[model samples]
Target: MDCREAREKLLLATSDDLPSAEASELRSHLTSCAACRGEEARLADVFGRLATMKRDRMPESVRAGYWEGLSARLREEGLVRSPGGARSVARPARGISARLAGATVAAAVLVGAFLVGWFAGLFTQQEKGTEPPRAVRPDTPPPAPRADEGREREPIESAPATGWTSDFALGNGPADRGEGVYAEFVLGPEAAGENPVEYGIDEALPQDPWVASIDF
Candidate 1:
């Protein structure tokens, strides 16, 4: 074998894990090559030290307990994937729904209370910008209408009526009219006599001229 092949086998041979064929080839190369022999010796020394050295190890009891705890934990996690196992977990969802319902009820009550209070205030308060109507009092039966109150009172007739009277009643009668059903002459006897008492030019005037002159 070449030095490279010899070196590869030598590494496996140091741990005594080389196949018999490779070992025989490595031995043949070592016999012929000084370099291969030196490498073999160095590798053998390292593995010898590794094999002989003592190391700290866990006790069988500790190892078994650790494995048991790990297995138990894994089993629990696997079981949690099942529906029945999922039910075992605590849920905040139901509690949240209950709280929401309670909150809604509380809100409704608050609204109702506010409305009632508002309506009560409206009804109890007096109206704005206008006066409240006066309350009607119960009628008292008008002093039982006295016995004499219903009778028609007789009014004494006035001689001259209250408002307006005819012109005859005011002493203004027609020229030919008489008073009190009797024909009384309203005109006086002729003012001038046949003989003149006090002579004036009006006495010389005829009756027709006098009438005409007085008119004109």
Candidate 2:
């Protein structure tokens, strides 16, 4: 026999009303099925404990209306009366209350988890701490120009050779170096081989030979 049938038989056996043939079959099934045997042991344990509990006697006044009130309540709940007026079939609530209770517990758990995660994140950020603001140094002025820095760098000194003597000098005047500089060019009799010819500072020379002005 299956465990379902065997368990029903075990319940009936508690009242000593199980038939001899069914008892024999159940005993045989229990011998082969360890699960059913364990269920039978549990049932026996529960019944043994219940048997030892003190039984309270019902008063006659309460007992008289108890059955009538129970029957009326059962009828109001749409329960079907069974045989012998001692049994009934109640309409199950289909676990509606249990499902609602389970949903409430699930929502509570989700809220608790979210709170825990938020607190954890907050604590982690606090532990890492914020970086201090960097100290900003003030902008510094560049160093002053050196005394020898304003000398003119002449590029004409590295030019191709010309058969002329050129002398360029700056005067010790009120202006800065290269501001009041002067240049003197001594002309030559030949284009290439002749010696340079000198002219007096006060002489008015001819202007037709070569004249070019250069700005420093």
TM-score of each: 0.25, 0.29
TM-score for predicted model 1 compared with the true structure:
0.25
C-alpha positional error of residue 136 in candidate 1 after TM-score superposition, expressed in Å:
99
What lDDT does candidate 1 reach at residue 100?
A: 32
In angstroms, the error of model 1 at 39 is: 0.9
Candidate 1 accuracy as lDDT: 0.30
State each model's CA lDDT, in order. Answer: 0.30, 0.34
Q: Write the per-residue lDDT of candidate 2 for residues 1-216, one digit (tens) a residue.
A: 765567546756654668999999999999987766765675565445333332222233322433344344444544324435533422224243233332222111221122222222322332344221222323323224433244222111211243332211111111221121112112222244333232211111111111111000
Query: Which runs in model 2 stand beyond 4 Å of their true positions?
Result: 12-24, 31-35, 81-216
| lDDT, model 1, position 2 | 68
User: 1-216, model 1: which lDDT tens digit per residue?
Assistant: 765456546645765678998888788878877755765665454444332222222233322333233234334544222234532222223333233332222212222122222222322232232222322324322323333343221111121322211100001111132211100001011123321011111111111111112110
